[model samples]
Target: MSRSVFSISRLASSCRSRLLELLFPPACVVCGEALDRPTPAAFCRACLHEFAEFHPPYCPGCGATVPQPLAAGKTCGHCGGGKTRYDLAVSLGPYEGLLREQLLRAKKPTGEQVAVALAHRLLQQHSEQLQAADIDVVCPVPMHWRRRLRRMTNSPSTMASVIAQQLGVPLASGLLVRRRYTLPQFQLSPTDRLTNVRSAFRVAAGHRLQSAHVLLVDDILTTGATVTQCSRALRHGGAARVTVAAVARSYSDR
Candidate 1:
């Protein structure tokens, strides 16, 4: 049975690859370099290396860049002082430069390819975190149904699903549901931001969620209120522990 399943999976993957080549083929999000043949989903060799590297010995709590030789990994003053719900958060890097442009384009109407590419890059950075963490299930920071209907895709959820697939973990879509369509968070003040996202999410009760360790996935972590709200919902729905993983972490006061 296992053999049959593996064979079927391989066949399905091959078919998908062929289809991708047939229509809307893969290209590097950075330089428009061809990426269809690359094993890892990213830009060409040069552009891929240009991405900022997040090495270990960093803060396990916030994924913040920290100077080494300290008692622990890279930890900022704020995280060490405490005020976060999720035990830890990991991000690939700040969403700036080419990375930010690519991510924004992906969220736009005609940037599906960029989204897929960024999802691949995110997996490469977070794979070890996924394996080492006590994560039993994966959930995405969902977009409101109305926004999803208008945008035609939930970029964060799509990226999360791809990461889950790569990590061989279960992607539970129905686990976390958005409750309200708040205004664009960028324009809101910090206080209003928290208020806006408060009670904005709910996790459904089910076999996949009860007492499970969840990794909440998203595209970016800015003020972190979005992730915090999502984590609250997951915890309220009986998540034992929740960890956040994002493609980029916006650096405040940088």
Candidate 2:
């Protein structure tokens, strides 16, 4: 396209954005405050700041916080004895307060703005760890077709897309897929949670990781059942390394 055409197109898009803003007026998704201008993320500065990173003393295995700091290579009780599939984990913070509120919103179609904003914030904070992993592929824990259609959004995938773009990594959005629907993990006992998601995921046929180092993105982690199963699938499918990235981790069963 010619420079003149590109300029005209940009101008037209700007005008359309301004017109929509005048009609609907934007508000922050978290605090419900009015936005001063139109932007992809409708989050206000105050609410954005509230989405803090989970500090250290967290388990290097699953990103779950420990009561006290441990040695550099320590694993928490849940992750010890070779129980999990992912190599390590990172998260925005523990699941509580503002983080929990925003995650719930991000699960809804109406929360796309919140989801995207959170992804960018995550990249800002965890870029070093995520990049240091030498990530070769970015994948989201896949939602079942039926559930995804009902919810009209998958928060994890939104996050994976943003992180993948910022890192200039290939996103294999469909690399791993849920084989069947299981009851929400939170509703089941930790023991039952393991059973519920066990063998529930697999690398989709015709799509395999090439001994890749994967960054598996998800909205939350509790017992880590779902992601464990997903990581197992990735490992079996050809991912040489699997690192979990989530918005929050909760000790819901405890």
Candidate 3:
């Protein structure tokens, strides 16, 4: 009797989904091609295939792809200076081509669906690395209140929430707060980028991250300044270690 009831419920849900699809046909977020059925991600197979994944020969410390392969645990020239505050960083892919287009779209109001799809992809591809890191909690690089209000959404927070849920880790969304508004990192020189975000983040009081391993989520990693600053704040708040996980990395210093 229970099995029969479950089957009926499943059938009803299938029918409802078909009805909805009929009412509003699903289209690929990237290409606008009609989809035969709903996909785990909103991308059509062709567009999904176009999305590149980052393969190694990358800097172990910063996750930046090196021009040539390096031995295990080797740092790239850029990260060899020991200047980064985060223990390590990882990104899904380079910030160009399809990934770039999708990420830019993700910043707009109409891009929530695609943004969610991208987050799902990020988790699918990087879950193993994240699990190996043994993170205790996940946190998004917080946006200033004013910017969040203006944007009506924080993509990093959204991605972090999804990642935390998938990894069964707690998300400390409120623990890290941005105290100052800084110029966009992309617009600043590498040196200026460092100063721009200096002292911009503060960990919330009463939220002790003592010896916690934190995974910091952000949409894009450029010069690494933003995440570095965020990592400093997390460490100051007593986090034992911080690792960054971003959707894309911009290789250009600018």
Candidate 4:
């Protein structure tokens, strides 16, 4: 399909979502109330107010919201005094309230609209960060093909496409790929999650990623295992820098 037609299709899908809201008047994904027009992540006013937002004093390296200012040169527990591959990771809200519900919805068969809306919200929230970071490409954490076929789509891919549209960046879905089929990371212990995803990704050969700054988009950053592995794959594939961005971050690192 022509690019213009493809864009219209996406816009049509978005409009369909709005129509569904008008017909059903979607209950707040969290608090169960009608949503305002131009909804952000399909949240209602009360639920938006209830969301736990993340703010500054975050670790510059890892981007986890620092609970409190740490001693100079100290790192957050999640960063764990070890280095991370990505330049930084930023999230809009904590993994609770409406934010959590929308993220979960993004995983469901019916969550595509929420995923796209959340991606737009994320891009708006990080406009400056994205612009300053010189993000040249957007790549989503890929799902294994078997899982992708069953899910009918990948939430991260849907989100990345929306982000690319808003930011005018190129969405590079084929650059990095999932090679292993594994159990859900959430079901595993933090340490096990890290081990489970290690080496699960590979970059497409001859992609020429060298010196390219990337925005790695995903729905949530829990143990950071998934992003870490994806970032490593990107760097290994010759990306100059990778910055992680997600809709929410899990409150506890442990």
| TM-score against native, each model | 0.82, 0.82, 0.86, 0.80
Instruction: For candidate 3, give the lDDT.
Output: 0.83
In model 2, the runs with Cα more than 4 Å from the true position are: 1-27, 34-42, 48-52, 65-73, 77-83
Candidate 4 on 1-254: residue-level lDDT in tens?
A: 99999999999999999788678875655556665554556666565666666677776545567877666556677667556778788777778776787788788888887787778677666778888888899999888888888877689889988887777889998888888798888778888888899999989876888689989988888877899899999999889999998888774342
Instruction: Estimate, for each residue in 21-100, the C-alpha lDDT of model 1 and write its tens digit.
Output: 87856666578777647555757777766657456655655665667633533346645444577867887766677667
At residue 88, what lDDT does model 2 achieve? 86
For candidate 2, list the clashing residue pairs, or say none: none
Q: Per-residue lDDT tens digits of candidate 3, residues 83-187?
A: 467877888787888988999888877778777878888777777788899999999999988888888878888888888988899998998988888887888
- Local lDDT at 156 for model 2: 93
Give the deviation of candidate 2 from the true structure as CA RMSD.
Answer: 3.2
What's the CA RMSD of model 3 in angstroms? 2.7
Q: What is the lDDT of residue 3 in candidate 2?
A: 100
The worst-scoring run of ten residues by lDDT in candidate 3 lies at 74-83
Instruction: Return the top candidate by TM-score.
Output: 3
> Which residue pairs collide, candidate 3?
none
- Per-candidate count of clashing residue pairs (backbone under 3 Å): 2, 0, 0, 1
Over 1-254, each residue of candidate 2 has an lDDT whose tens digit, in order, gives 99999999999999998898888898876777998875555578887667665666667777766788756666788666343577888877767778889889899999888899888777766778888888898999999899899999999999899889989999989998788998888788988999999999999899867798999999988888888899888889988989998888787463
